[model samples]
Target: MSSSRRLTTVGFDADDTLWQNERFFRITERHFAELLSDHADHDHLSERLLEAEKRNLRLYGFGVKGFTLSMIETAIEVTEGRVPARTIELILQAGRDMLSHPVETLPGVRETLERIAGTHTILLITKGDLFDQERKLAQSGLGELFDGVEIVSDKTRTTYERIFAQHGDGAARAMMVGNSLKSDVVPAIDAGGWGVHVPHELTWVLEHVEPPTEHPRFLAIDHLGELSAIVEAIG
Candidate 1:
C-alpha cells in the first residue's frame, strides 16, 4: 500500500461474518428436503433447491425471502407440481421461523468490534434483504458500533470502491473483513483495499472463491479476534 494510504476504516460483512446466519438456512434446507422426500429423493431435492437458489438470485436476490421462494420453487419442481399443500405450508412455516430466528453474534465479534471501534470507522457492508439485515443489526445490539450500514444488492470491486470512498477516506484507506472470498475479500483487493478473509464454518457455496495468493494487502485470519492486531500493524 502507498504511504498516503493508511487503514482508516474497516468494513465488516454481516451474516456469517458478524453473526450466525447460513447454518439456519442449511438446517431449513434439510427440513425442506425431508418434506418432499416422499415425492422426490432427498439428495435430488437438495440439488434442485441449490439450482433454484442460483436461478432466483437475479430475480429475488439474497436473504430469507429469496431462500423461501427458492425452496417453494424447488419443492414444486422436484415433486412435478404434485407437492402437497400441507408440505408447502410447512415450508412457509420454516421460512417464517428463519426470518424470526434469534440473532446470535459469533464468538469474539463484539469484543473485536469494541477494541477497534474508537480507532477506526467501522462500517457494516452486507448484502441481503434490507429489512432483515436491519432487523438483525437491531436485534444483535451492535448497530451503535457501526459508523455506517450498507445493505447492498451485490458486492463487487466497483461497489467496494464507491462504498469505501463514501464512508472512509477512499479504497486505499479501507479494509474489508468477511468470510466470503468472492463477495467480501477479492472485490476489496481489486478495489485497492485490504482484504481479510475470516473463515466461517458454513459458507454459502456461491460465495466461495480462491483467495488471491500474491496480493500484498490480502490476509487470511482465523477470526475477528485477530482484526485489531492487523489494524495495529497497518497503522
Candidate 2:
C-alpha cells in the first residue's frame, strides 16, 4: 500500500460475511428438489436450478424473489411444462419462508465490528434486493454500527471506487472485507483498495473465482475475527 493510504474506511459485505444467508437458500433448494423429486433427480434438478440462476442474474438481479423464480423456472423446465400448479405454489411458499427466516450473525461479527467501528468509518456494501437487505439489516440489529449502507444491484470495480471515494478518502485508503473473492476481493483490489477475503462455508457457485494471490493489495483471513488486526497493521 502507498504511504498516502491510511485505511480510513472499512467496507463490509453483508450476506454470509456478516450473517447467515446462503444456508436459507440451500434449505429452500432442498425443499425445491423434494417438490420435484418424482419429476427430476436431485443432482439434475440442482444443476438446472443453478443454470437458471446464472441466466436470470441480469433479469432478476440477486435476492429471494429471483431465486424463487429460478426454482419455478427449473421445475417447469424439468417437468416439460407438466409441473403441477400446487408444486409451483409450494416453491413460492418456500421462498417466502426464506425471506422470513431469522437472521443469524456469524460468530465474532458484533465484537469485531465494535472494536473497529470507533477507529474507522465502516460501511455496509452489499448487492441484493433492496427491501430484503433492509429487512435483514434491521433484523441483524448490527445496523447501527455502519456509518453508511449501500444495497446495490452488483459489485464491480467502479462500485468500489465510487463508494469508497464518497465515504472515505478514496479506494486506496479503503479496505473491503467479504467472503466472495470475485465480488468482494478482486473488484475492490482492482479499484486500488485493499481486498480482504474472509471465506464463508457456503458461497454461491456464481461467486466462485480464483484468488488474486499475486496482487499486492490482496489478503485473505479465515474469519472476520481476524479483520481488525489487518486494519491495524495497515494503519
Candidate 3:
C-alpha cells in the first residue's frame, strides 16, 4: 500500500461497472413478459426465460441473442407453437433494440476515468459473450480511455494471472476494479493483485459473494468516484 509500490496498471470490469447494462435487460424482459401475457402466465414465462438462459449459458454463452432465442423457445414451448408470427417479430426486435441501444455510462464513470487515465495504464477486462462485449465497447465511445480492452469468457484466478502476465506487470503492481465480488475481487486477490470492490445497487445474485476480511490488499467502496481517493492514498 506504499505510494511507491502503488498500482501502475488498473484493470476494470465492464458490465454494471463502466455502464448501465443489466437494468436494460431486466426492462426488456418485462416487455417480453407483456408480449407473452395472453399466451402464458407471466410468472411461468419468466421462469421459463430464466431457465432457458441458464441452459443456454452452457450452450450458446451469454448475450442478447441468446436471451432472445430463449424467449422464442419459451414461447414455442408454452404456447405449443400457437405464438403468432408477429409476436416472434416483436421478440426479435426487442433483442435488436437492446444490441443497438446507445451505451449510457453510470454516474461519475466518464469523469472518473478521465481523472485516472493519465496516472495509470487502464485496461478494460470483462467476461461475457465475445461479440456482445465488443459491440458494447464500440458503443460506449470511452474505448479510447483504456490502454487495452479484453473480452474474456470467464473470470478466475488463472484468468487474472494470465492477464497480468500478458500485460507484463507484476501482480503487486496490478489492481482490479469491478462490481462483482465473486467474479472480480476474489480471483484478483487470489492472483496476488489488489482488489477494489465497487458495489452496484442492482448486482445480479449469481455475481454476489462475501469479501474476505483481514486482507491488506482488499478495498471496498460504495461509489466508483471513491476510487480516486483510494488510488491517491495508495500512491
Candidate 4:
C-alpha cells in the first residue's frame, strides 16, 4: 500500500488491455510479409515496413488503415511501382478485414469490469485512430460499462496530466490500468496518480519500456480478474 486514501476512479486502456487487438494486426503483417517474400527478403521487408510505420506514426498516427496504406506504399516502392493488382488488393483487404472483424474482449475483462463498476467511476482511456477505436468500442459491448471514454491521438506525459486534471480532481484518488508501460504506467505515475499494470502476452515492440521501481502507487498483475482483489487490498 502506497497510500491510505482509497481510489475513487479507475481508468482503463482499451486495446490489448481489455480486448484482443494487436494479435489481429500481427497476423495481417505476417501475411503481408509472406506476400513480399518474392520481391524482397522477409527481414528486409519487415525492416522497411517497420521504418514506414515509424514515419507514418507522425503523419498518420495509429490504426489499421494507416498500417494498410503504409504496406501498400512499401509494396509499390519495393516493386518499383509495378506491384500486381492482386497484391494491392490483399493489402487493402487486410485493413478492411480488421474493421469488419468483431471486437473480442479478453477473457474475464467484462466480468472484472462489471464487478468493479459500482465501486469506482470507470473511464475508458485509449489512444489511436478515432474511427477505428470508436468502431471497436461500439462492437465490444463494453462501452456502456464506462463512465467516460477518451480517444486520444497520443498518450504522452502531458496527455496524462490533462486527463487527471479533467477526470481526477483528487489526484491521490485515481488509478490507471493498462498494458503499456510507456503509454499507461509511466505517464500515469508522472501525473500524480496510481497505476495498475496488467501486462499482455504480446506487447508491441514500439510500446515496450522498462517498469518503474516498487512504489506504493505501482502494482502489476497478470490479468484483469486480479484487479478486484488488488484494489480491495490497497483501499
TM-score of each: 0.97, 0.97, 0.89, 0.93
The sequence of per-residue lDDT tens digits that candidate 1 reaches over residues 168-206 is 898998999999999999999999999999999999999
Q: lDDT tens string, model 3, 1-235?
A: 2346557778899899999888988889899889888877878888888888888877766667888899899988888989999999999999999888888888898888888887877889998778788888888888999888888877889988888778737667788999999989989999999999998878766687889767999999988999988877877
Question: Which clashing pairs does model 2 show?
Answer: none
* Candidate 4 stretches greater than 4 Å from native: 1-5
Per-residue alpha-carbon lDDT of candidate 2 for residues 1-235, written as tens digits (9 for 90 to 100): 2345488899999999999999998988888888898988989999999999999999999999999999999988999999999998899889889888889999999999999898888999999999899999999999999999999999999999999988888898899999999999999999999999999999998999999999989999998998888988988
lDDT of the structure predicted as candidate 3: 0.85
Winner on TM-score (3 vs 4): 4
**Ranked by TM-score, top first:** 2, 1, 4, 3
In model 1, the number of clashes is: 0
Judging by lDDT against the true structure, name the best candidate.
2
Collision count for each candidate, in order: 0, 0, 0, 0
Q: What is the lDDT of candidate 1?
A: 0.92
The true-versus-predicted C-alpha distance at residue 12 of model 2, in Å, is 0.2
